[model samples]
Target: VLCKIACMSRSRFYQSFKQKLDCTPLALQQQLRIENAAERLKAGESVSQVCFSLGYANLSHFNRRFQAQFNMPPSLYSRKNISH
Candidate 1:
């Protein structure tokens, strides 16, 4: 849909997006989702709620991505933030 709106093929859009952003579209999406999820978690949302609300059906996958991005699981991150 975004590609259609931009009047470019998927591959072309990905190529241009990567060139401009220095990351692929999927990477950007994952980064954005993780960042938003982290914010919500810090704002006092439960990990499971944030995971599903962010459209991640697999809790393990969400945990791994969140851990990779922040070097800590969402639960730990949220707890640490709340303690501070």
Candidate 2:
């Protein structure tokens, strides 16, 4: 859909996107999702809520991705960052 909107083929769009952003579109999307999840978690949302709401079907997968981005799992991040 983005490729169509950009008036470029999929490969061309991927090449241009990578050249401009220094990352693949999927990587950017995952980063955005994890960032959003971090904000929601810091706001006191539960780990399961954040995971499923962000379209993550598996809690472990979400945890892995969250850990990869933030150096901690979502539960730990929330516990550390949430206001008392």
Q: Show where candidate 1 strays beyond 4 Å.
A: none
CA lDDT of 36 in candidate 1? 97
> Candidate 2 regions off by >4 Å?
none
* Local distance difference test values of all predictions, in order: 0.93, 0.97
- Measured by lDDT, the strongest candidate is 2
Q: Report the C-alpha lDDT of model 1 over 13-76, residue by residue, as the tens digit.
A: 9889889999987899999999999889878999999999999999999999999999999999
Tell me each candidate's TM-score.
Answer: 0.89, 0.96
Candidate 2 lDDT tens digits, 43-75: 999999999999999999999999999999899
Candidate 2 colliding pairs: none
